[model samples]
Target: MKKTEEKIIRFIDAHKLIEKGERVLVAFSGGPDSVFALHFLKKFQKKYKIELAAVHFNHQLRGKEAETDEKFAKEFCGKLEVEFFSAKLNVKKLANSKKLSIEEAARKLRYQNLEKLCKQNSFSKIATAHNLSDNTETVLMNLLSGTSAAGLSGIPVVRGNIIRPVLCVTKQEILEYLEKNRIAFRIDSSNLSDDFKRNFLRNRILPLLRGKINPALDEAVYRTTSNLKSQLTVNERVVNHFINEFTRKKANGFEIRLNIAEVFGEIPGELLKVLIEKNFDYEFKHEDYAKINSLAKNHKGKKVNLGSGITVIREKELLCFQKEESSLTGEVEFPAGKKAKLCGVTVFIQKAEIEANPAKKKAYELISADELDEKFLLRTWKHGDIFKPLGFKGTKKVSDFLTDAKIPASEKKNRLVLLNRNKIIWVVGLRISDEVKITNKTKRVYKLWTI
Candidate 1:
């Protein structure tokens, strides 16, 4: 076996990234690293009896150059007698739509397409050409971007079904092997542009660091990353056990309730971080972790919203991670004598002559139509909003009233308030303004009901 092939095989064996006879899909971009990966994997395929296939994704950034790269990849795969698949993505459009950087968008799209291709073809493993230099660059990026120990550990060799076989080799080695074999590969012009952060690191920063600080920096970082991965594995097992013991599936299995006092008391923050990330597949922000630590230390009824409809509420004894219910539609216009759907409630207003029943409170409030000067507006309760309760003497802040009524904070935003000419008339589903209350002498009434 050649030296490069031996290195790759050793890494694959150590990581258990592949098994004999498993159909593997290679992400071939016709670049040096990917070309070398395809070459080495094809060479090793005969020994392991594994079926090899190649996939190419054109990011549609380099215009005609991208088409040429796709052609090169397809022709190369044809020459190797392997099945080739090609996909095109408008990366700029994707990035603009998703509000992601070009690099991030391209990566996400490539991986998504690769995963779909693997599933469609029944391939067990998806191989990528990430090399040792890639890992070092990632570690540096993570550090510069406020990362933890896990981030410092660098990218995993085996992440789910995606395997990086060339992570064991360097970019220099891949280039050397490709040159030694006289293999032709296309160069991506975008990679040479240092406008992107990764490119800036790869071209300018890393090369300078390699020349001045440490020539063997990549190997040293790789060793540290490998050690951290081992430590992380042990930590993950312990954290998962803690999570399982303290948490119960809730909300039709959409959420989990964790006994914070029992499980996380005196526990390290790192374990808690891993617990949430590993189980929920969500990364907690810095403030979120701080709030969690506060929950453990103080055991107060505090809440932290982790975005994406996910909220973490810290009760006295338990912490609940729940998917919040969608709130009512924002600000709906409610003209008098007209029924309109607002906040998932059909609000109706009509001037009616009705007898007041003393025994039963009206399902819909009967308000004197003359009292309302402008159209009723249904919207969320805002800060500094004041309204008089049906029988109250003085005005009360809507927030204080909700707090007194023990309305959970998560549901407050969905609480609808009916306003007349910017005046609070009703806290919908709760109470109506005293000014709009029907009286014994009332003849003309405006009926307001949410169905």
Candidate 2:
């Protein structure tokens, strides 16, 4: 066996990239790198006790060339006697529609289709031909674009079900192996042009840097990224511990206690950033971290808009991170003796006889049926909305009532109210208005409950 193949096999085994009897799907682009990967996997298929399949995605940007590549991929897979799949995507159209670069669109569509194929075929793993060269280029790109430690770690060797067995070898090694075996492979014409950033780096920048600065640049970058990834793993564990310690899950979003002296440090900002990205899949910029740390030390009631519908508000001793509420603007009419779903809560109103001891049923409340109109409007509480609680003598603002109830400010905007004739009847799941409470003179009672 060739040294390249032996190294790749070792890498795969070390990472546990494949298991016996598992089905593996290879992303075949008909390029030198992918061809080498598919060939290598086919050569070792029996040894590894794995089933092999190949998939080709034509970006449709190269017209006849793209079709030719797809044809080559299919024929190549046929020669290996492997199951083949092919897809053609309008990458340009997708790029335009999504406002993303052509490369980004192609990558997104390709991976999405690959994942779908894996599910449909019950494939346990999806393998791609991302070599050492690709990893080095990725690290350089992230460095130029100003990235965090995770970004500096470059492409992951194993992300979920996707594996890169050839990642341990460089592109030159792949080409040499293919040439030695006289293997046929299609060259992507786009890769020859220096139009894209990656193409420019691969053709121009990397070669120059490798020649002038460091001939062993790829090996150096590989080592650096490996170290960064190891450190990131440790940092991530610490960040997760802090998140669990400080974060409080609320109905609207999440809260991080800032009263702790440890939370005022730099790690807390990183903890919050990770929590936001993990929960909402929204990444914040480096400047956003500084702003969050500043907000943590600021006075209460100040807020910082972190864009993408995310807001960070400083409370007395906590920092609330939540998505801006899109309150229910249109009122929903709730007829008597009916049930309706409002704001993810199922509310039911039924005619019932007032129990002798109403306090026993905490899940529901009894109200004077005569005081309600034929129908009630169910909507989010608005500013200036006020109601007199069952025990309070004077009307209190809905906002103040929520504050007094210790409801998180993030949830106050989404609080629902049951209204009769534009007057608050019940602050759903909280207090009921005194005017609507069942009394001795009440002839009919309505039972209100939410689940």
Off by more than 4 A, model 2: 60-64, 89-105, 189-195, 249-253, 260-264, 267-274, 282-291, 294-316, 321-330, 352-363, 383-397, 437-442
Q: List the residue pairs that clash in candidate 1.
A: none
Q: Model 2, range 1-451, lDDT digits (tens) per residue?
A: 7798889989999999989999999999999999999999999999999999999998888889989999899999999999999988889987786566788778879988999999999999999999999999999987886666777898899999999999999998999999999999999888999988888999999999999999988888999999988998999998788777878887657888875546454435457667777766355567777788888778777889885578888887788888776655556897988887777877788889978876654888889988567798888888989999988999999999998898866566778899878898999999999998777889988888989
Going through the candidates in the order shown, the clash numbers are 0, 0
What is the lDDT of every predicted structure here? 0.79, 0.85
* Least accurate 10 contiguous residues by lDDT in model 2: 260-269
lDDT of model number 1:
0.79
Lowest lDDT block of 10, candidate 1: 251-260
Off by over 4 Å in 1: 241-327, 330-400, 415-451
- The total number of steric clashes, by the backbone 3 Å criterion, in model 2 comes to 0
Screening candidate 2 with a backbone cut-off below 3 angstroms (N, C-alpha, C), the clashing residue pairs are: none
Q: Can you give the lDDT of residue 364 in candidate 1?
A: 69
